[model samples]
Target chain A: MNSRKSVEWRKKAGIRAEQGDAAKGDKLQSLGRLEPLEQLESLEPREPLERLEQLESRESLQSVGTLALNVNEQPILVVDGLTLESSSGQKLVEGMSFTLRRGESIGLVGESGSGKSLTLRAVLGLLPRGVQLAAGAVQHTVSSAMVFQDPRGALDPLCPVVKQVAEVVRYRQKKGRREARAEALKLLGLLGLPESLAREDRYPNQLSGGQCQRIVIAIALACRPDILLCDEPTTALDVTMQRQIIDLIATLQQELGFAMIFVTHNLAIAAEMCSRLIVMKQGRVVEEGLALDVLTQPNDPYTQMLIEAVLPLPERAETDAGAEVEKEANERSGAEGQRIAHAEESMPNTVKKSRMEDLKEDSESQAEGGSKS
Target chain B: MSAELQMEQVKVRYGGFTALNHVTLHVPARTTLGLVGESGSGKSTLARAVAGLLVPDEGRMSLGGRPLEKRRSREQRKQIQMIFQNPDASLNPRHSVRRILSEALRFHNMTRGRVQTEQRCLELLERVRLSADSLDKYPHEFSGGQRQRIAIARALSVEPELLIADEPTSALDVSVQRSVLELFREIREELNLTVLFISHDLGVIHAVSDTVAVMRQGELLELAPKEAFFAQPQTNYGRELLAAVPKMPTASGLVR
Candidate 1:
């Protein structure tokens, strides 16, 4: 397929083509047109296509018992009917079930209070004081590692960023400090970050939100565990940075070949990342399926409602009347380099027109009605 | 003042850092105005300042066309009620819904009689779509959406003229979020209350607001009708925010 050639070529080209430099980027863009691989080198990496491939490679269930369990296969982690109850007897989550196979990625998705995080916490034996794992069985292949939402929240303010990552490497792998620090740099590079950040002895406060998240990912990867659990890893990041982190995780999953359980509220993100998606509501699996089918054609009404509420703004409709006004403002504020860096592409025609006409009509509408306070 | 609530050149500062800078917004009698911004943008600061929770560094504020005193009187404080985003966090954990509402009524000296107050509490809960049975229940028993409705009922218990909500549905999921938003709409119309709704979600802003004010970095970027703001945003930041919204493709690879 055309995709195969382009993906192979881009894989060879690597970082040189990933950056938007015209020459290598042009070659990469052409590669994107060939097949599934061609999409990988497009202006933005083809995440959904890559994710779909990963989804298909997941293990089929041998037995359709209440919880997913296969006798012959290695169970990296097994959790059955996990339930958490608060002090007030409020059922945070109940009757949740799932199992992870070796080198598999399973995504846990639900609104807040659906017990997605609690499920992960129960497996790790880390439930909060008021909460208890009232029911369930948690068995795992090996010790697990976790990456939290806020890097600073989990990291010690007194310690340096590299030191925090090194501590994990030293403790879990029993490596020397010097050896751990050296390994940390390699992990940072593998995650596609500059080597300089890995060397910096600065604290998490000094780094940007995206950079801090990278450091958190670095520490999680340092342990070299059989299973990795991430809780809303990209919730705190901007859109562009969010894409970078998701790509990093996907790449590492392929290379390290570790079982993973990703928990997040964003279905769009879940659609583009996970191998198999497990939908939860009031503590039960409402739906479970291949990522694409779950997002595009949800069987459950709750899941469908969740998808519809996303409010996809027209990419290019120009329906937004404020576009021209914003454009003028942007032109004034964003001198050459600034505006070019953040230019909007992938906008649809409907949105483009809607945004343009929205502004044009605003002036006429203002004239019809007197000025508002 | 031209309306029931008016804020001019309001500035809220913590120590040396400015949280709100020269913010001027007016809420006409019984009108709903949506305040939209991301985290650290100071929309919540403005809401708190209006509710008298935080004194502004520089600004004149008035309620009911009367300039507010340097320190609000007990009667004056009751007129502006603030409904917090997280109902579970805001409500007293030990108090039943009945005690929660009655305490507000008694504290404000608005209670007529015990039987009447109990009846009023039931009415308020019913107004927010809760049944009379909900009065005996604790706040922890309800869902995130239901708890939010209870919070709204408590806010209404005071019978305040202005309502300030900071990211009310941000923590709830979509299905619950939509229902909560509809509840707000119903209360706004039925009560003829003036509302100042603050949130970071543009989708929620579009769903609830008539007029929208876009704020960035503690400054107002654009203020316009909801349709106009969505159609043609007037500021660079505003456009960037609009563009940042993710596209929902109807079919995989085929642009909807």
Candidate 2:
């Protein structure tokens, strides 16, 4: 524990963590444009008068922040003393508080029923029926969208995938059919889905689990959401497919520059994509710190247990450092390029096959080079 | 009391689609054989074939050098037990844990009278580290991890020689998964049972398996001792699968 290298590493981490997200506010802008409250109000169903009428003043106050909030200067969300209770007065989430800076990513890491998902749902204003906010406030300046755990279940089976995305574009953006469809296609393409499938009109049933998830991401993006809420989004996918989805989401966040609140039970994932990590257990914050500090020098027993529980990465096949990972990147990009080039002739099948092969190749090689057994 | 499980060129086809394409594998007695593959790669189908849940179109499966027939005899059926992925789906919601465990014991004639069956059910619960109070609770009353334990308990009720677990811990949290994997390992050693453990997570497979098997598109790619397979896979496809696992960021930022 007293090694010189360890001390230097800890010192370096301390300096990095204290830097804060304040420096990155300048170049960041949400891919989804900000819309006025009145503009979004008209997009709501006319028959939802009863629901809109029931809107609490607290919600309106938050919306006001959404307007006065500038992407460059202010924090996107500030949740203060948030408490959640079930219908029978059982406290579900206790005194949760965190600030999500503009265009920065924060992860809420915990085990299931740890209230991480509940907290994310509360922020998105979509808590399951009977669970209400008991105390405190969730105030955000920008509107958000969400990606769910089960991709296929989140989508409509009866509708074509492209139509489903375009519908969200139509409603949220108030764009006409041609413009909306074009926007939807652009979003899909951004998520690494092929451009050709827009013409074929593939249904959810026809696409692979990974492709369907990309479509779901496209739907979320179509809203032009300033912040993205993701809840165990890749749990249902195959590992390689899960990797692809994670990579795709990270890339999108980079290109679009949206703020993110990613909730996951896996600490390894949280470490990869998040700058600040909040470790929650049993509806309470157990540990909150910079992701590097939390991963490398965990203070809480629960956080320590989670870090240990992650399966160690098997050794890579190539002994020379970084070559395998570099090759993996090259293969993925090459295959993705190949996928886009040959996408139209056999839209659904070809895309799935090529992507699977690409992922399978890396993992297969990884498994070979990995575990000492 | 346990025996090896062997599958020889087992082939299963549903309509025109070949679910198991001339695949062959073996789980040595008193050892675990871990199965890894992506979805639609026919790993589950192969498990079903070995369990006698579905009749394979071709090839043979044998337990301890004896043929495991397409339609197994009652004794043969009792020798191999299968655990499904979703405990909620596998366990009857309306039935109490006591009823579920007792039913399996009685079906295999593990005990005679009600008192004896109830006694055996309690033992099954104890084997999986659940308290006696859990006997009266329904599956829904238990958490995801506890429910999976109940599933494991029921699978062990018949004292099967070969255990088929299909992604049993995939539904559980990591901390819970660690305990379940431990229980499985302990049980395998104590009973000398041959286990066909399937999971997409290589970390898990690494923890339990004496040997590893890879399958893709219904075809077996490679089979080797866990060390050799992970160290230097014979086939290119096998190496690629190893490469595909999401690397856990290790301590000191040195994780693969």
Best by DockQ: 2
Q: What is the TM-score of chain B alone in each candidate?
A: 0.94, 0.97
Best by TM-score: 2
Which residue segments of model 1 deviate by more than 4 Å?
A1-105, A112-115, A118-144, A149-153, A157-160, A178-214, A225-227, A234-260, A309-316, A319-373, B1-4, B252-256
- Choose the strongest candidate by lDDT: 2
Q: Write the per-residue lDDT of candidate 2 for residues A1-373, one digit (tens) a residue.
A: 4454543553343222111122232212222333333433343211122223333323422210111113376677899989999999999999999888655678899998899989988887778899999999998766677888899998877778887777766655657888778878877776888778778889999999999999888887765666888888888988778878887887666545567888888887777777678999999999998777788889999999998888774564554334665687799999998676544323433344667775676455446545633
- Report lDDT per candidate: 0.71, 0.78
Cα-based TM-score, every candidate? 0.69, 0.81
lDDT of 1 by residue, B1-256 (tens): 1136788898889898888889887777877788876666789888888888888889899988877656998867877888897888999989999999899998887878899899889889888888899889998898888898888888888888788888898767677888988898888887778888987767778788878888877888888878778777777667666655544445534231
Tens-place lDDT per residue, model 1, A272-293, is 5565789888778899976667
Runs with alpha carbons beyond 4 Å of true place in candidate 2: A1-72, A317-373, B254-256
Candidate 2 per-residue lDDT over residues B55-147, each given as its tens digit: 999999999999998778999999899998889899999999999998888888899999998888889889999999998999999988899
Q: State the weakest 10-residue window (summed lDDT) of model 2 chain B.
A: B247-256
Worst 10 residues of 1 chain B by lDDT: B247-256
